[model samples]
Target: MKAKTIFIVIVTVLLTIFLMDNKDAVDFNFIFVDDVPVSKLAVIGICILIGFVLGFLVGRPRKTYSSYNDEIEDNYPTEQPKSTLSDEDRDYIS
Candidate 1:
């Protein structure tokens, strides 16, 4: 089998073992909160899923200025190299 398939099989086996080992129900309590009973594997798996989702959302690609500028320049270009302001406006100080 390919390396990826082997790795996937290994991970699946390990996860199955972990889930089987954590099947017992556990009581969880937070400060000032009532106790909650849930399977240990369920809590662990839920937390892992939440972490992955949050990481994916937070690590998403952001808008880049170079791509935006390239698109704008491709769509709009000035006819001349000089500024559009009049000579009086350009030479106000100098």
Candidate 2:
């Protein structure tokens, strides 16, 4: 099997075991509420879902000044920035 398939299978088995072990109802506390009876599985699943969502939001790609300018220049061909260095400086760099 592919590595991805193997990993998914392992993860699924572990998650199933975890759910089975945590099937009991427990008193859960929230910021505004106190001692709410909720399933352990639901509590853990909700926390995991929140973590995944926050991770995706934090890790999503963002465009910087240069990349935004590049996209605009590629689409519109506006006045591109040119080098202002003297030939001596260019030769030194080379």
Candidate 3:
């Protein structure tokens, strides 16, 4: 399996074990609410989901935009770069 798959599996297993061990209810306090009775599993699962979403948003690649007035050099050359090759290497390529 891929590294990402393996990591997800391990994390999921760990989370499952943690949730199973902490099944009791606790008081969850939010911005507008008082001590609301909620399961520890729910609170922990929500926190984990929010963390994953935030991590994905922060780590995801973004496109860079250039303005029309800005001067930018051509980073990608159309011509192939020249490489110095030995006689044996050239012969092998041909």
Candidate 4:
């Protein structure tokens, strides 16, 4: 089979084993709530789902300008062309 299919199969088997092992109920306590009984597998699945969602949102690429001229201008002054000839030098050249 393909590598991707093999990987998916392996992950599915591992996840199934993990869920089976963590099927016991556990008590969770939050600051604003009393103790809640929930399956360990359910809690692990929720956390993994939340982590994947957050990762996808945070890891998305942001829009950026590709061209150099498309960039934002700063307050820095650009270099001006300097004249090599003065008034006396111009007379000599003429």
Each candidate: what lDDT?
0.85, 0.88, 0.86, 0.83
Candidate 1 segments exceeding 4 Å error: 1-9, 65-94
lDDT for 66 in candidate 3 is: 66
Compare the candidates by lDDT and give the number of the best one. Answer: 2
lDDT of 1 at 41: 93
- What lDDT tens digits, residue by residue, belong to model 3 across residues 1-94? 9999999999999999998888899998889999999999888888889999999999998976764434333555567778799889999999
Model with the higher lDDT, candidate 2 or 4: 2
**Poorest 10 consecutive residues of model 4 by lDDT?**
68-77
In model 4, what lDDT does residue 37 have? 93
**lDDT, model 3, position 45:** 85
Ranking by lDDT: 2, 3, 1, 4
lDDT of 1 by residue, 1-94 (tens): 9999999799878977998899899899867876788899998888877987999999999877678778888888756577778889879957
The residue pairs that clash in candidate 1, if any, are: none
Residue-wise lDDT of candidate 2 within 1-94, one digit each (tens)?
9999999799978987998799899998899999999999998888877987999999999866677768876888577678899999999999
Candidate 1, lDDT over the whole model: 0.85
In candidate 4, what are the lDDT values of residues 1-94, reduced to their tens digit?
A: 9999999899978988988899899899867877899899999888877987999999999877564554423433456567788999999988
What is the lDDT for 40 in model 1?
94
Lowest lDDT block of 10, candidate 1 = 75-84
